[model samples]
Target: MTAAAIGASFRPNELEVRPDGSGNLLGSLCRSCGAHFFPIREACAGCLSEDLKTVRFATEGTLYTYTIVRQSTPAFEVPYALGYVDLPEGVRIMGQITGVEFSDISIGMPMVLVLEPFGTSEAGDALTGYRFRPADVTSD
Candidate 1:
């Protein structure tokens, strides 16, 4: 598979975190409707316009909804929290919640995106994925 296809399969529409370790998340914005999208798209779904612009998301958002997955799945690790986060720019994104236990997640909690290794790409190469963590958690 091509690199683009592998990236698309691994991250879908979310920004590509560079392998060199810059740790930047690239997102897509709709120039026609002001709608933001993760993983940058060539076309704007909101306005059906082809003029989509690429930008970096703030990485911070409010927790919208979440669930604890007790069952194991090939797509993700077990005992992980999966949820949608509402970005300040009015975009909602789906990602896994990390750095906290399932018992601590609450609706409307503040979250920030963090780059972490998720799984391998479709081409059997190491792939990095984004996960949400409580904003209050410090690097220390």
Candidate 2:
């Protein structure tokens, strides 16, 4: 696979699109306390550790809580599932849900992060981004 095959990351700092079409959500890990923070925190919230390192989070997680948003802002459409997933690294992340029927989504289900084209840049270039789907689901 090549970088051209998968497109570029929507937000390079938050989402990293690997050449193989798979990607990981980017976060910061506290070197001192092992605490992980999403969106790359400047300091560890749990232990107040300033020595943080960038890390790619595990793609798999467990759905902790969710909401089916029937309405949203212009950038997002309605009838989307928004959820909080608990990663094994001890971080809770919020992302859009995909690849499952609205009624089929449930708390505690196994989830896996996926990368897809999110939108276009000002130059009209494709921007790859991350979302979550049921672990058992197949992609088209």
Candidate 3:
């Protein structure tokens, strides 16, 4: 891993990382129907219009559902909380849950996007990814 690889976004197309350590999740906003989609779409799903634009999604959302995975591939550690959060833009995003006990998490709880070290690359370079945390919880 090279020094430049540190703090790099795991998926640059979906996430934008700033030099000041602030970042946002990228998505597409449909100009015709006022809809938003993750992974940035080329056309509007709601109105079937090609008039769409890239936009930064809101960081806050509501917890929709979750589960704790006890087993997975070697790249991921077991017993991590995974959940879908419904953002204000009307998109549900899947991400890991952190900063709170698994038992304490509940549906409808407010969550906020948090950027952290996701994992290493094939070359052992550090990568930045995102997780959802309880909105009331402050970072250390």
Candidate 4:
């Protein structure tokens, strides 16, 4: 696919897929309180300040917690791994866990963000999204 097509984000406000095929999760950084929030909040929850800036979050993080999802809406597959990843910015992001099995995931494991094809848009174009994988794992 062309870079323009591949860079189409599943959730444009949350993920940014660059032309070089690299990407970062986007969030809001509170300049007033030095706090960070995922999903790009308009205000700081800590200080209730509107002085927030859009920032790209670090790809590396620690797996804080997780669960095996055996049930979900038709849009999602069953028995997928889900987890909270604590980034260096002190924000915890919930995402699907990949590159590791459900039985192998553990608390405090090093994780890294990975961009992939999520699903097709209404126009049948590919949409990019993110998943967290063990940092030690490499794509085959």
Candidate 5:
């Protein structure tokens, strides 16, 4: 299968699933200015660097801020937590917070990245996406 074929049904970025069926999301790291971007970028926003290397991000981060989305959107489910995560590599990402109740969410909480089904593309293929879950639940 082609890269588009596999990534078509999943997230915006190409994902690699290990033999254990664990997902590892891929992103681009700017080789020139050391900037990292999720969903990948053709050029670095900091230095306008065109040389980017693909990298797999660590599946852990710290919650920066969040909001309990009570209203449903076309692409997201209602009562979900959406927030920015401060990755260890110094890049901040906006994503959903899963595996926890909305009442339990707070700033500076520990989180782990996980792949989830977001919605669909324009062509109607299921679009898998990434989210951050409370680290406490996966700490065992």
Candidate 6:
């Protein structure tokens, strides 16, 4: 890692990147209803319970669906693949698809989270962010 990368930190909300390059998505787990939510809610929507705890979601998920995005805001580049990945904890996460050709992505392929430099801070510091990538595996 470069010196800038070593000093990078994730933006508050969905990501929690560690210094060791091992991190997970931030979410809320409801102790009452056993439900998980992304973006860390203070209360559980499932059971309307306030007994929620902040938790880190799993890094791996299965691509539930995808699309080729030809239009987006200026901050993002065009013609990117976007998808909703189904995590093991029952939360569906939306991220920019990466590490594979658009034609190769499928509805059920295994995916893993990977952190990259998303942008820079106002003070010109690197900001870490995440995206989903193709899982390492071989076909039978």
Residue-by-residue lDDT tens digits, candidate 5, 13-132: 656544333566678899998988876789999899899998988888899999988898675557778899988877788888889878888999999987655567788775555678
What lDDT does each candidate get? Answer: 0.76, 0.90, 0.91, 0.92, 0.76, 0.85
Which wins on TM-score, candidate 3 or candidate 5? 3
Q: Give the range where candidate 1 is weakest over 10 consecutive residues by summed lDDT.
A: 1-10
Check candidate 6 and list the clashing pairs: none
Residue ranges of candidate 2 with Cα displaced over 4 Å: 1-3
Quantify how close model 4 is to the true structure by its C-alpha RMSD in Å: 1.5
- Candidate 1 stretches greater than 4 Å from native: 1-13, 19-22, 122-125
Model 2: lDDT of residue 3: 64
Clashes of each: 4, 0, 0, 0, 1, 0
Ten residues in sequence with the least summed lDDT for candidate 5: 1-10
lDDT of 1 by residue, 1-140 (tens): 33343232246446566545324466778888888876677888788898888787788999999999889767655777899999887778888898887889999999988776567866777666778899998743
- Model 2 over residues 3-41: C-alpha lDDT tens digits? 676878988999888788888898999999888889898
Best by lDDT: 4
Higher-scoring candidate on lDDT, 1 or 4: 4
User: Candidate 1's C-alpha lDDT?
Assistant: 0.76
Misplaced by over 4 Å in model 3 are 1-6
User: For model 3, how does the per-residue alpha-carbon lDDT over 1-140 read when each residue is reduced to its tens digit?
Assistant: 34454488889999987766668999999989899999899988788999999999999999999999999999899999999999999999999999999999999999999988898778878779999999999998
Q: Give residue 70's lDDT in candidate 4 (0 to 100).
A: 94
Q: After superposition, how far is residue 58 of candidate 1 from its true place, in Å?
A: 1.2
Off by over 4 Å in 6: 2-4, 137-140
